[model samples]
Target: MREHPNVIAVQDALDAAGAHTADDAPSLVVILDEGAHTAAAAAEALCIEVGQIANSLIFDADGEPLLVLTSGAHRVDTAKVAAALGITKLRRATPEFVRTHTGQAIGGVAPLGHPKPVRTLVDTALAGFRDVWAAGGVPQAVFPITYAELVRVTDGTPTDVA
Candidate 1:
């Protein structure tokens, strides 16, 4: 499972960016015994608060792919985000569009392991947690990272997404 192509890509991207957990440990992707298709499920599996899950969401920002790493406990306020970004139209991306740009399925897009660099916004809400968990390019895999590291690694702007 660790060698899964998607996981490998995620790990390679993490390494290249020097991503680390809150404790300064190297971020290593781990495959859960069961697939965590949602943030609730992932938090339950990892025995952590739902807010600690950094839900990787893909959105269509006026025709371009946009990534938002928001906290599981908060729903993304698209209108607010769009207004803040000065985007004419910001809506949820279709599954096909998400897969096309992220090279990963809807439920498992990592922050940094994409086919191309999508414009990203890290939710300011996520900074409250010491260690946030993110998808590892697949539904069954995840990795731990700090809020600062996540923003830095993805070159994402810190924004209030909710």
Candidate 2:
């Protein structure tokens, strides 16, 4: 398969994180819809429900990157999240801020293997699914992960994102 630079970077990060094995490398499918920028769009392209799509939202917490993997069907309640995290405030990150911290673009951020571990939160709603998919470092690439594995891989705390 052809490899994009971003995809390569994702592979490197996955390797570093000791995620899935080479024998079980996740498939990254590039869909025709570039508009798959949102979870609802992605789910439509993949023929899945919006809830099945995981939105890798970035929050700016005192200039630090805070990652939230939320289900598409719900909106993240930032105030609640901040309260849960014991942070006084949380703001949506800008595109530049996202790339600076995640080394991946907004529509294609993955859960783990960032240059540094962004303080992460996995949506409790995701636990409803047996499997979940995340961006594989590129907009077109994605991989499957279970809710349990998502927490294990990201070392993220479980909380209500919506």
Candidate 3:
């Protein structure tokens, strides 16, 4: 089946960023019948540990959109993140806010391909896994990438999110 347009956009973004998946272990985009909207669902579908899933989350930090690529194993500690960023508050972005910022729905927000650059924070915890799976701008589509590559591609700041 042909890939979704949103997924193609993500693939194009990765390519433009020179973030190719490893040639030896080519990372193909997988499409699932059931949406891998949640990190748990994605991990189960990909047959990997939950922690190997990178959950793309958007938050409203001091009225700006902030992207947090957190691990599936734990929840983000908003307080810690806010304090670390020297922000007064960090609240979860609503569906409308997510779509507006990411140009993608909540469940399939990728680290890249936003209409404009969004400040990103990648979880240091994801470094524990050699490879991690992330959304591909569509809930049913997913792709594999290394934690380091993810950080480089997104130009994300590495920090502890949990």
Number of the top candidate by lDDT? 1
Clash count, predicted structure 2 = 0
Q: Rank the candidates by TM-score, best first.
A: 1, 3, 2
The candidate scoring highest on TM-score is: 1
lDDT of 1 at 122: 97
The list of candidate 1 runs beyond 4 A from truth reads: none
Put down candidate 1 lDDT per residue, 1-162, tens digits, no spaces: 788788999999999988899788999998999899999999999999999999999999999999999999989999999999899999999999999999999888899788889999999999999999999998999999999999999999999989
Query: Whose lDDT is higher: candidate 1's or candidate 2's?
Result: 1
1-113: candidate 2 lDDT, tens digit per residue: 22766667666655555564224554333434454677877787777778877788999987788999999899999898888777877999999999888888888887765
The per-residue C-alpha lDDT of model 2 at residue 81 equals 86
Q: What are the runs in model 3 whose C-alpha is more than 4 Å off?
A: 22-27
Candidate 2: list runs displaced more than 4 Å. Answer: 15-35
Global CA lDDT of candidate 3, please?
0.87
